[model samples]
Target: MPSKKSARLAALTVAAVCSAASTVVLTAPAHADSVRIHDIQGSTRISPYAGKQVTDVAGIVTGVRTYGSSRGFWIQDPQADDSPLTSEAIFVYTNSTPKGVAVGDAVTVSGTVQEYVPGGANTGNQSITEITKPTFTVVSSGNAVPAAKVIDAKSVPAVYSPQGDTAAGGSVNGLTLEPTKYALDYYESLEGENVQVADTRVVGATDPYSELWVTVKPWEHRNRRGGTVYGSYDSQNTGRIQIQSLGKTADFPVANVGDVLEGATSGPLDYNQFGGYTLVANRIGTLKSSGLQRETTQKQSRGELAVATYNVENLDPSDATFAEHASAIVNNLQSPDIVSLEEIQDNNGATNDGTTAADQTVQKLIDAIVAAGGPTYDWRSIDPVDKADGGEPGGNIRQVFLFNPQRVSFTDRAGGDATTAAGVTKVGGKAALTVSPGRIDPANAAFANSRKPLAGEFVFRGKTVFVIANHLNSKGGDQGLTAQFQPPARSSEVQRHAQVTALHAFVKDILDTQKNADVIALGDINDFEFSDTVKILEGDGALWSAIKSLPKSERYSYVYQGNAQTLDQILISPSIRRSCDFEYDSVHVNAEFNDQISDHDPQVLRFRP
Candidate 1:
């Protein structure tokens, strides 16, 4: 499954789309005699016999998954089909736990052919051809399962997906499958069949759900940290496949990035709602740890002020990772002078009981930091209206500032609240906030159900530094990279674009007031550095994202579905970047490890104001 942070809105969107698409029903024709599994699967993404009934489909059960809500068995025909584009196996969608079904049993199934779309039809994910409402009889026992298809680097094509047909609204559903030409088509060709991958590198760590992602093509977009770097839209890593176990969760191997799944990992290829293509393994391989250690950034010099941004994945007081997070801050981060924390939940967390205060949550983290041999850090934040800011319900997630009082002083001007907009004012020929610890534009529609940027003024060595912390709208409900539509539509970027536009205007207001003002805007923008959202925020040269100053290989702060990319950032004004003396680091503490306190890697920026 996807991370819990973004799954709420994504689940709602998927349900709505699937509900509308399921309304269309076609009357079934007379049941035809003895159809091959490949014949039912057809040569396209959609089955030719969809909505029609087929009888006496003979195959051997290769996998029986009795666990989970969608329990079913996968059957594959031993007889070879001439067309490589059509799959020889298919999943029988039994609504409940399958009874009296085991692997290697020869059976004949009768059912209606259907195309089930994973993650809903609106997501543009390719549909899985399956048999629904199936009635099967075991013909024989202890039959050998078909040979597992090997999916190594050579078997998968370099091409990610074919160009969708323009006539069909940029969808490849109507196009014939070319397994040898495209990677998506190659995987679709072997859907529901047993497949094997040998010694694949773990690109994504084993998450809470006992699922991880691996790359068959190890060299594709590989970063120095053994992650597949998603540099651009054109280079979608086609070899990546999500792994889940059909066995007990305890038996599943825990892994991290750069680790290896030793030996042969064999499983049935299936499509699911969370990840598009998944391998439900009946046989798991041993986990070979790579000893990937957490990275530590150099401590800032006396003249430098270190600022950091970390999204603590909906942190609450009840969470047990507070100690580990505190240790990361003290040891790995070296205790930055000012830290911008995003997704800090309310006192009661996700209870949804109209609670909005996050005092307990913030205090717990501060206490843990102090216990971990860190300086006593003070904080400032404005509480949002209960459930007004989009996040876990009742959590009331918001941006917060934690500063070391011994190093820097916070300028706290009164009258800042959740609704009041913060503006720039010239105080004695210098730029200053009208209301410190205030929001950028709380009333703006761009931030209607999203977090508003919090602007605060800080004094470090007699210099005024304006800092804006933001947690913009998430990228939920967006089409995936392997979607049926070519160059899948990023619908979630619409709000992010608007959000960054408003943020840019606020930064411009500060720069317009005082041209040489030292401004540092940092937090989880929830978009990529190369994305239009970042470009909009950097428009008119008002700000520049500090992550860009590093080498291309070292710019990522988040990893999703085996793709290492940027979601957290720190942008600076002309005064900070003109000197060209800042040090930026995307600390590799959380995103690359199996044991993680957060999903995002914290970013640090050190410079003299």
Candidate 2:
């Protein structure tokens, strides 16, 4: 588990990596007796000896999934096998290269059993993956799985994704989400893992590359599955996996609407979304999406704009998501003209319909905003996702800025310093892929999952204030959290330091050119006054935190256990620092996102000349 500090720093982020290979291949899972595995992680403590290399360990083929040439199948451990925590059938995978396999086909799998800490984001797939040692292969003469009717987590059901059908039917089995297991750990890993799952009704195949999502126990594992999200963080990762399946029953061979899925084992991938660590999977399947809906047409009057940040804690936008969450986000902090939000996910639009549950929806957030009845914020903006965006395979996570556009002009095609679309696309110019940080090069290198600062020039006051939105490195404090300039900390600390250093450089560059420039560095910096990165930035004349000059209670934006500390921040440049009357308003560092959309609340800085 990541430390409290790390989780807060980069609640959202990704870095670019060096090079990734296209190697993805796996023979099949060897079906043997029902072997039981227990206390998985505890047992597999990496030792100096034992089966030194990859071996053939087979169990019952619980699941199978195919993605391009990359394929995977899950082998169930009887829950009593004495093995490393890793060996206990959580999730496993091949190299980035593709493989050949189909659903329900049991065969022998020969791969190395690794004993080490998985160095990446947690998506419930493999805490670790093994390089195949190539063992013998065998096919099962067993029966085939029955046709599944793809269900969702809602009370009602639909035929395909709300967007309608395609060459690859967007049908899928469902999953119930939970806060503990999935949301915290497993949920993060779903971005891109070639999972070997049994009994999923292959919904939509857009082209030669098919699209699919895995399912767990539908309806019961919402946090574990369901919503569309991406988790890859950098060059080290390249895929996204959705809960086409989560919790399923053993007896229910015939999947019905809202039926839970069982018999599933997944493989980790080399390519992943953003994580302090990298996801290494051969191939990733596309999860269906209800897509995004941006409404920029409403008229607006500009005056006082209130910018706030809320955790929205695991908001699904589904019919049952907090049912009471609507009011919490409405905000008492000045009728919000532009509010930055976190943790809201995509559920199928129109919860009012007689649908059992939602698969993925773009309107979910919009509906939540409306449910708040700002009555004042009738005008808004949202990114309408298409068949792409991979339907948020890592669960609902993405920092969103809600403004009138009347208030803030969005740089539609603004992002990335990568090859094309700037940093938007990953995996060889895939038009609609998530972007990791590390754009305009800096002296400090930026890798995947290290949250990069998002910059935008916002016209505030008569002049433009350079806005650099940031969610630093989270998860065990960036593995890089040591005293960059100390000894013996995970390299994660190094990653975060690099991230902050790059951010500082970027801000410095912006300031160098603009004589009277005002740069506001906001959002979970994840560091404090004494932290290495913060010290470096402060040393630079870059900026200072608004909370630095506030009362103790007002200094904190998040509370861990019982200790209140300031994680979210509002840093301003020298010029901007002395330009306004700033007050730090702390809402609820003690509250969860039922009303609190995220783990960190907004640090309100009321600055007026």
Candidate 3:
């Protein structure tokens, strides 16, 4: 088993995948299958809530119970204490970008509620909500803030990770920060006048609170309607960034802390909220102009280069050519700005020698990137591989990644395949998780291993793209090969559907943001263009099969018993299709390259913001 820290990262990395998208609109109030609305004002809605049915909403999110992504997020109308007229909110993204948003952002969601009462906001036990989908639209748009930096808060206690104390520590770039105490594991605090921030800054309207009883933090990021929206600060929420007597707080001014040092908006930043020290700005400041720049995650990038993905067969690194493979990878393809590696295994019970898959794979990939001779890349892999129930005695499969330093910055990682981690599930697909690989009976809770997907963001030619790299149920003719016509029915299908569910959740998150979201869902989906999973994903038309831009004659990624099937694929949010440069290269698998190393091939797509 991997260390708890890595395991925590994995869960946080792939945490929010889950939902049942509502396609039908019902006039009846008894069910939330869909709600009919002809807004009194101009209305916008992405079908199935940007491809997800159940979503969390703030403002007046009613009809609370359990809902969304197997309860990874939920909604509630818990009566307030009655001192203030606090409205209800729906937690649409329990797993995706948890801390980016604040407590009071107004949003409207469409999804079912839950059977259980959630523990607290950061406990990770919101409830299981599946058939989930929702989008964020700005009834009111708030200022933007950086993602992982710290904003000094005197009264603000240290922030902590969801599982333990202090999510972030000290020093990044040129600035240093105090470790996060325990304000909220996944949320930014707005309770006091000064708000700690890093990464991105808030850009919104200003407020006029002369009496100054209204202390605040920036709002949370949420997905609403057809457009993406963030929280704002008004009388209801923090209206805008304003000035005040920020009380003296603890200072750890080495990283992006200490408010506007070196003429920057808290410069010298660290990416993770957990590892670095951060500072609170003592004086009022403008949202930093040049700390980190991401147009928006999941939104398409602006460029001519095509983006692609592949399963690389069982990307298991062996000793014989572990060095050789690394050399070849860097020499041949070099390091992709962001590449997703799947079917990766890590030691489960110390059975597989003392060496583990996670470490081995990261080292090899990083080594290869170094050999390739560009800027060496940073690699991140899931800690506790999502254990497939009863499968393989001790091998755990995980999706891993490598990032090119010169090309992009590693923004954040979310949601992965670990069962022990909080707010995670196998409801979408039913593969049971095991300490090892192979099969277990369908009855147990599974951290089913599919092609592990990685979610984060990167800037490609100034345009930011939020990417979800997936290697779905293999098209090896064995993974759900028996039920190609249906969405996986057996445990195998469960694993397949789990991948699908996760992908859908990803789509939901992307759509929840901006109008022109650049989303790419690529990898060995296992299902072809017409398969159940593919069809379901493309159903509402919110997503476009990026491969469709390529001629059908060239769509196949793998050969199944000699039949041409598109095992590898990409799906782009509709917002990015017309402007995206989507393409694929079968050259690797063609008569020219060795097609036998892995059954699947690679595909790419490009976007121009």
Candidate 4:
């Protein structure tokens, strides 16, 4: 039952240096020689003079931050370099409060130039060039601030990364930067320098920490809902940048996708551990309306029963996403007759109280749907052994069902519990669940610490339909693409394959019992539709992936980095597929927007019962 505010906030400390309004004056020394900031911060990622001692580097103190582990101040030369690829500012890492320096004080510092990686050097992350062990003498105070360079949509490059291995193969921590064509290079060129973007559009939803993301190149690589599509390798969209209030006079305004920044966004460009190339703003424009509205689909006809599956992302009663989720189910999804829900948490959420029941949570969602002008839906699920189901500790995330009693009726039977496996049998020439709302082979070793599939029986318009809701093992332990291994092993799929095999066998058993039985298995499968895990799920054509019926470009239900991928699906039996009456819709309410309540979007299937 974790809330949407679960994303960790970036931590920062208050500055102990001079205020932005400080003004003082002093005379410069009689020395005529000095080192330039651009020479210390070269055109490349690494400084040319790194690990060497330098004397008398002069600049105006633009910022002084004396409050953190890497305590430092930023200084910029009033006379900037002619090349756009070279930056004029460099950070002087004091590691403590320096005695005679403050913002607006033009000074000369003597120190050793070094490149420090925020994390470890082996983490494949970029490094920051800094001046450390510094002694400085103030020459003058309250000098005029250097004019900030303006960076707008036209100045940004369309390419996301440099070509080939020369740019570290598009790695986030790459060492090479091609400022002419790469987005990463464009941002790196202005590190620690103040810049501005005008008439921009907010792409991501504002987070609990009051930060958001915006796109300067709004039309390029745009998705249907106005988000810049993020893709891997050469197709990556390099337009989006994170907005923070670190250098701002006020906090960033809460914004949704398509909202405009009417005045302009001006700030210092920074790179950090959480996300790269963030624009830390001190002043932002007023938010203007984009007139964006929530979408709703057409309701199902008399002959068709609409079924949907949604992963609510660890929902609990305390979560505020329930109302928006209910609106999605009612308006966006058109009130599907039966819905499969994943990640339903226990009543106390992550309190670890040993309680396994989710009645309060399920009731809250049902009430929300009813309040949103949908039917009064009934729910069915078996509580798992305390903490046995994998999720947030003590939360016991599991799958459950919400069925509209006015359109469908649950077939209740006997002999089913958390550990007892459900079986199929023939009843009046149709397949029937031996135990209504039962677990499918709950004792099987393949489902250890994972959500055991919840099977149920239902009748719509005098026709029987069987469904098994599932939330399989995630892609947690797999090695990333940038791992030490060349083709990073997806070992997490071994367990998912085993889980899919069990599910495939269950569908085969039911089809063997009655050849014409209508069966569907749907939820977050945690693998691509064309992946080996899905290949095993469709073993020998036992069940076909209904999502393949969609166009190749439209088959996605989730977007990661910039690639449109599918991690949720609905697979159906041959009997249901042969009729050709099934219609599928990967509703686009959630995945494309930053204001989305869930990370995964819901998929709907409509067919004659």
Candidate 5:
């Protein structure tokens, strides 16, 4: 019969990679047809004895997850084979209580072998090889559980994946695992087993879901804020892993970057659909602060312009995060002269009305900025047609600019409207925008359902600086890192590449007429600094990404899945780069917090205009 614990402990069936450990010896009946759990787990990604009937399987019950749809108990063979490439423990799926079996009970079970996916086969989730419809007899109770194996810095490999086949364009999979060399192999080696990681550091913010990520090795790819910089494939970041307290244990604590887990954390490793491989801990350690403080940019001096890009993350009047955002801008970013804001929703956010104007919303933000002791800023943007620009349905999220009138002046020409496209025009022997606040290629198909680029001219210290605020296509449809495809498809970049191409053509037009035009294209580019989209925007060094000027470890304005990465960027023309006095700061306020005002932290760039 199904026990009450079955519903909550259903998650215990999720398992991960394999590893070797000292096995415990227990007395068991010498059945002629007994099978070992390691023999069924095998050495490959799939089980060797899957879908077959095993009459007698004996092991000590290390874990009892009696609740949830995946109600089962994990059994570890006391006498295990000496193979680092195979796990010793396997989950026995009973779908209900197995009568009197409990943790530390040495039981012999008979059941049919199965490969069960948590959400079933259609979800592309990995399958856990288990014994279902089990009938188990307890030989003894109150016996000691298997010793928890320790996985420290030396235990994990520095490489991410094995080299993929040449025909598959370097996609990794279907290869023999050498756990001593590759990190993925090492984790795979310990799948479905209890293990411990001691003296680890939390590398990512504890998410709203009460889960945090930790790096077993805190010295590799370390960021300024103590997060790990997710470099390209060459910089194998092997020590990062997700941590969760299975319902069987106490709630996992919410933590930030640089927090330390004192002593040892013991748990069973699980590979699930949400995060690839996670350590679901049954025992947690004390969390300590690492003295990490939030960073602020160096103040801009006289004759210098502080330009910034912030994605307010669907900011609307109804959203209660306005005051927090205003405080971040005024206090954290130090009130940049010109700020490019993305994801600004219409007056009634998500109401789905015919209204496309955001005048009230912008005015409220300006009032909040002044209330927060910031500059009296003026804003400009050409609102998009209702429901045309992509974002939250009926929210009409678009990009806009906030410039301090005392520090800079908007160079208004004439004739800019919601649908009218802007062009580069020659005014008095200098490159000038035809319309002061206008859209760049509003009618282009590349920007369909995406925020169009808002280009505007500003005069800072008597020098004209053209700025383009953009919110390109997001990384929505891309395949996940743990996707079934070896090298998961980055199909979302195709649209972003086209969008940047259009922006590049517009900037090229201005640079063609005036070779040394001061053009600053900045916003949530939604692409990485090394991405092809940024490459197309740079176009042989015509414009350089200022974030690249920062140290490789500090070049991120966003963090996702324990990887410190960059999604917001500031790319300045050669004129700004030649000045060589540019200061770029990824003001880290929001991204690394459990109660984040927005998903993305802002980027600030200060230079002589």
Candidate 6:
């Protein structure tokens, strides 16, 4: 789903008729008394009166939104209706800031009913019922607003959504909503109506866009650090709701995970493109900080080797996060012997000037680590072709290995370049890489427009170890959990599955040559631990993800839309896992904090070879 601001900008550019003040006349006008708000809403996800004009729909103004491209006011009918399946309120889009509408004003609006789908229909998002090109007259002033319907843990069903009808192309748009059976249906039933959630926990921190996420059910899949864990696809945390403010952006609270929104947070329930259902709040609650602190992992012993993986989130030479990232590596991670860094952008980041070198970027980070009282690290990586890899254009993001020479030594072999393929061979009856810091099958179709895996050889205490670093294809084009298609399609997984298959075969080549060889593959896998991508990488017992060794509640290294999930992982071979003497920790430092240097938390693995 797209962000609300981006969706609004798209609307402003594409839909010109929405900005007109004249009445938009549709096919035929309906009788004033026959077309109630509920009658227009019907009992389905789409409005029954869409693309038709309705006259004199009476309601009281519940909230007024004067910001963004989609400026509108919500009107709710005070008169009660018996059915709980239809909404009593509707948004009257005024195109610009509404002039004479107040929160307590009673108005009768006459306009064309439109089903506005944010981010367009191809995104599979549920459409929002709105009365566009509206003309309204105030009937009364200073009237009481309708009572807000409370939404809590008991009201939301455990089941996330219903299976879409096969006849309708796997869309639940035409089916009648069952508010009691499914959580998505329950939210659809209250669309455009005034709602409230009391004393909720902040699961996602306040992002740069001034929006945060909260969960009504505080205890559902709650982690030790007060986050809702998304263990699997079947267990979607249905209590999550995105919150945006109608007030000024400066007035929005700055909150971290585990904080509390004390008192009543009341607003009109809206469906947007970013997160499925959102609360466009007129009255936000007071923030109570929980004092959630960053976590630090125990340092590795003299006999043990510590290796870590961290995605710096597109680090460049000009980024201000260098010092903070250095502190995180030295203090929080306890200075791992070998670190696999992902998204290390070129020196001229995102400039598209055909520059493909990242020596300046890497050297700046090494300097920062030394300034932070850490080891003097040596680095090795192959520069990618300009604009060939995916990510910000001209960034040429690739994986790099940073090793502390005092504790470990890198074996450098020549003849590795951007387009060459690395192979495995045997040296002294031990598995060895032909070209150290060489790419694995760089020209394969599976790695097209994506980062290729980098393989390196390291020696720790006279023991040889093979490390493969990867940043797989991202989950950019997949459908959301609240998509109209039930069991939403993961189209992005096709390329990821192919990439992991190639990776699995490469790992097998080494293990087949030497059955007991020690290998550690780590980085941002960009898929869940239980996903097919991970399973393919672990094919035929060639490797195993170390994240599964920890308890279920402590497996996540990323927080997305209030669901604590896993996108980064470290996998070990039979030589490491079979010994059963390794420790894995997903350090929780950045993902849960408001002042974050990166969106992903680092993962550390410690073991003696």
Cα RMSD to native, each candidate? 7.3, 19.5, 26.7, 9.4, 6.6, 5.8
Q: In candidate 4, what are the lDDT values of residues 546-608, reduced to their tens digit?
A: 989986556767754334567889998888899999899888777656577887889999999
1-609 in candidate 3: lDDT tens per residue? 334344334322222343333222313223234332211000111122222233323232211212222222222222222211111222343434333223322334444332121222122221212223333332322422222223433433433222212221211101111223433211222111122342322221111211011112323221111011211111111211222221232221211111122232322111111111222233333432223211111312334434546454344445343444454345434334666665555633324453345676567656755665644767665454334422234545555656666666654434333432212123224211121211112222322444345554555666666666555565332311111111122334556765565557546644654545666666657666655677666656657676666554445554321124555677887767765444434433321112134445555554553
Tens digit of lDDT per residue, candidate 6, span 1-609? 234345334322211136533221233334333378998888988776777878767788999989877788999998868999999999999888887778988777778788887777777777888888777767667999999999999999999999999998898888899999999999999998999998999999999988899999989999989899999999899999989988899999899999999998998999877888999898899999999999999899999999999999999998999999999999999999999999999997888999999999999999999999999999999999888789987799999999999999999999899998999998899888999989999999999999999999999999989999999999988888888889888988999999999999989999989999888889999999999999999998999999999999998999999999999999999999999999999999999988899999999999998
Predicted candidate 4, C-alpha RMSD: 9.4
Candidate 6, lDDT over the whole model: 0.90
| Candidate 6 residue pairs in backbone clash | none
Residue 563, model 1: lDDT of: 88
Query: Which is the better candidate, 2 or 5, if ranked by lDDT?
Result: 5
lDDT of 5 by residue, 197-264 (tens): 88888987888666788898879899767888876745647888888775533466768888888998
What's the residue-level lDDT of 337 in candidate 6? 98
> Native-vs-model 1 lDDT?
0.88
Model 2, CA-based lDDT: 0.37
Worst 10 residues of 6 by lDDT: 7-16
Ten contiguous residues with the weakest lDDT in model 3: 37-46
lDDT of 2 by residue, 369-476 (tens): 566764324222232222211123434233445554535443343334322211222223212113222232322245353333444444444444455555556535
- Expressed as tens digits, the lDDT of each residue in 275-361 for candidate 1 is 878999988888999888899999999999999999999999999999998998999999999999999999989999888889999
Model 1 worst lDDT window (10 residues):
11-20
Backbone steric clashes in candidate 6, count:
0
* Alpha-carbon runs more than 4 Å astray in model 3: 1-306, 323-335, 347-357, 373-375, 389-393, 413-452, 475-495, 590-595
lDDT of every model, 2 decimals: 0.88, 0.37, 0.37, 0.76, 0.80, 0.90
lDDT of 3 at 87: 15
